[model samples]
Target: MELLSLDKLAARMTPGSLIAIPADYSGVSMAATRALVASGVRGLRIICVPTSGIQADVLIGAGCLAELETSAVTLGELGLAPRFTAAAKAGSLTIRDTTCPAVHAALQASEKGIPFIPLRGLIGTDILRQRADWKLAENPFADGADPIVYLPAIKPDVALFHATKADRDGNVWIGRRRELATMAHAAVRSLVTVEEIVDVSLLADETLAAGVLPGLYVEAVAEAPRGAWPLGLQDLYPTDDAELARYAEAARTEAGFRAWLDRFLDGRSAAA
Candidate 1:
């Protein structure tokens, strides 16, 4: 397995990649989102449930990519807006997967290197028919019930995440409610942003391990301090609402976003 330092991970991601981000309203993966936006990537489809993680909110605030809302609204309803009503009017698409299980199912098909997976419990539902992106079918394992929707696999060029501690080799200890591992499994390649890289010895102890994101699957690691905000640390830190307000204010206006970028996000501060 190849091990890349922060610089390497920062270097590999470019503007052309399509990405998957945490679909929750908390522990928002800011580094991963910012890095992709900085590169000029085409678009990103964030996952969101009714009111959690608002990952979509922060992303939209940044003027980065179009949004993919998995709520009650259809893609047509959202109008392809990332953070803007105008962008959506420009033709953004939305689907009503509405649950993590369904979302993961689609990604699983991609991770397994298959074209599509047969799922159940969504047949004749609004999500299956109205959302052209999703292909719904019956589950072979079940006899009679709602059919399943084939969620697509996500092959991100890079996976940037914040960890409590990971070793230099890339074995990750992502505690609390983690969607990173689930994402890492489906991505084509990945990266980790850690608060600390611990000794290789500690990784073996089971108590320190609720879940481990194996290093072999990761190509790079970035040592980031205060990396996840508006998104909390597993147990150490809480989401910073003030910081979020700062971001929201900046993104509310184009002039504000550009000015904020020049002062904070564009140069040395961005990398920090």
Candidate 2:
């Protein structure tokens, strides 16, 4: 894997690229997200594995996205993601509404190099009806008129996230976050930001190897200390609820969001 500066890593993503991002509780590369925003990359299409929070909101607020496919987008305790809500209300964003399981099934299908995967849920839900790509088919194995949903594979151009650490050999330890592995496997390339890099080989240790995503899947890595700031990295830091609250409040208005974005880009906000 190539080691790169954070800005350079962000630069690798081109306009209108399809990117897969994990949920907030997972390893979110907030630092890299900031760099991407600063780089002024636009017309991105984001696929939140299941759901997302501040990371997706920040990108949408910055006018970097043209389409979004996800199960949901919320700021958790901080309330609705103001910018996302505003964009959705104004019909400025193309939204592909999906269910949590459907998102996972689509990625899994791509990981296996399959064209589509059968899902049992969403039989009577509006999510199934709205998704033109998802087709309804009768279960051939079933005795009667049982129907199933077939979700087309969703192969992203890039999978981006943060991790606790990586080894010199470029293997990233995601601990129990297996979804990150799924994303890397399904995407064409993966970009990672880590809190640190160690000299030892992560795959050499049997225990560590179990939680590691091999370097084969990683295209690049950047050393970004506290890379998951304001969103928290498991066992390293807590989510900056205060900062999230401030963002939620400030983003309620378009001008307020612009002002907040200025502080964010200028590195004058909390934890900057």
Candidate 1 on 237-267: residue-level lDDT in tens? 8866554455455545566656545544442
- Per-residue CA lDDT of candidate 2, range 1-272, in tens? 99999999999888889999999999999888989999999989999988999899999999899899999999998889999999999999999999888889899999999999999878888988898999999888998899898899999999999999999878999999999999999999999999999999999999999999999999999999988867899899999888888889989998888888888776667435
Off by over 4 Å in 2: 270-272
TM-scores for all candidates? 0.73, 0.97
Weakest 10 consecutive residues of candidate 2 by summed lDDT: 263-272
Show pairs that collide, candidate 2.
none
Off by over 4 Å in 1: 1-7, 24-27, 39-86, 90-99, 111-115, 139-148, 263-272
Every candidate's CA RMSD: 5.3, 1.2
Model 1 TM: 0.73
Q: How far out, in Å, is residue 148 in model 2?
A: 0.4
Candidate that would win on TM-score: 2
